[model samples]
Target: MSRPHRPGSGIRSAWWCEFSTRTPAFGDGDERVLLRAQSAETPTQVMVWIRLAVRVLLSGFDPRDTERAYHWLDHGQWEAVARLADGEPYAFTAAAGRTHVEWSARPVLFLPLAHTATGPLGRCAEPALCACTARGHRCGGHRR
Candidate 1:
């Protein structure tokens, strides 16, 4: 089973995406961070999460570039959108709220869980006992 998303104290993920392609050979690399919040106390909204995810995945370009984004989840795989050469951020947001030509691109957040991994809470997805998850206590098991 997967770890239950705790919300307030969620996981943080960061990755570098080479967004700009002005040089082709040396793209403008940027860092995209997503503080995955599973708890109700999370401050970031779903759209913000999606936007940040999109921003990281679709880094680079301006908010006025004309390149269109082409992404779709087909057959369990998230296909990559067409490279937005000088693409803009608004394009993706605008791509939503409308059904265009063949590609009816919309921002419907679909968070599919991956296979479970070893968690801090021994035998459980919860954090280990004590303050190990934060204060650095040598916790054992999922509870104190």
Candidate 2:
């Protein structure tokens, strides 16, 4: 017989974001699904934006309209997803707990760009038109 496939065995540690449109109480909608991750060693701006997008999406989720709401994985919750990934169930819970505590202690400041007369003058308005430069990425400065 073949041994069960193990997930996350290659990576030492990582940060994962999960979203679900169902509640545990009902046990019907997709729950504890692993969505994406950021390496523990180096995190990129794109991954940070993905996390921010999750936050924004969750904030706007209306359970009343969809009959379910989405949420991110945090606060010592990781067993179900770990099982699905075929990793040590408690590993994620422990790591996520540590990460949660660490982040709660030191919160990053995020400032949204100010809107212009036409519209936001940054990639926040039109990402496709944004240009990459030596210094950093710059917005196309076009109105939507």
Candidate 3:
């Protein structure tokens, strides 16, 4: 079994994601914990975090030219959406979860789990992701 998730304490701070191509990499639980410390709730602290993120990501890009890029960790996976040399849309995602991450070129509708699906705790999935997108988490698939 996996270790229980404690809130904003211990090594796990709910869930954290970095937008870098390297450094922490994806699925590194310890790094996730470290990144969570960025929640300082101040403008300066937030700016520092953003600068760190930008420095890490820019380390991989060409300095002489501008390139469109976006990357972030989602549910412990590193997701990158960028344009190729030919300017074609490209996206890649990888995770340590049991259910394969599914994406489609065409728009896809995802259904949410019924309220009854969650027990009394209402933790059908990661309570955070549930409140936002329909993505499930850490449950070995089956939509949590």
Candidate 4:
């Protein structure tokens, strides 16, 4: 079930859409807590969180964000990220018959989630592509 709309709730919704890839991973209790926290956050705070999560994912240091993202992102969305990471050309250095992988730093790009018939909080069959344009409707994009 979708939550009731409140002032600034769109920001929270948009954050979920962008960060979670529109997959609702949270349980009812977790959703309540996260929504409350997100509702209290400013736009700048949300952006900072997104940046930190992306940085953590790219660095491959912490698995927490990755785990969360796996739960939050649908299969196609996760596969897209995996493909991007896998396609990255990394250098390998060999020393003493041992090979070490060195990953090159790549710029992370934030792409907006495509709108679906179920909206941001709903389950979509095709999570990677936008249905709004295909349905001949204009999407307002993300809410400010």
Each prediction's whole-model lDDT (CA): 0.28, 0.32, 0.30, 0.32
TM-score of each: 0.19, 0.21, 0.24, 0.19
Q: What is the lDDT for 47 in model 4?
A: 35
Task: Write candidate 3's Cα lDDT for 1-144 as tens digits.
Answer: 899876542232211222222234456632322222212222233334444454454445443311322333322111221212222322222332221121111111233444555443344343223222245544334354
- Measured by TM-score, the strongest candidate is 3
Tens digits of per-residue lDDT for model 4, 54-95:
444443523554454444433323443343345332211111
> How far is 94's C-alpha from truth in model 2 (Å)?
20
Off by over 4 Å in 1: 1-44, 60-123, 126-144
For residues 52-140, what per-residue lDDT tens digits would candidate 1 score against the true structure? 44545433433332133323222111222222112211122322212111111222223334454753323444311122245533444
Error of 4 at 136 (Å): 44
Question: Roughly what TM-score does model 3 have, to 2 decimal places?
Answer: 0.24
For model 1, what is the error of residue 87's alpha carbon versus the real structure, in angstroms, after optimal superposition? Answer: 32
Taking the tens digit of each residue's C-alpha lDDT, what string does model 2 give over 1-144? Answer: 999977543424333332222224354543443333222221333234334444445444444322221323342223333342442212211122112101111112223445789865755442132223435433344333
**Pairs of colliding residues, candidate 4:** none
TM-score-based ranking: 3, 2, 4, 1
Judging by lDDT, tell me the better candidate of 3 and 4: 4
Pairs of residues at least 3 apart in sequence or in different chains that clash in candidate 2: none
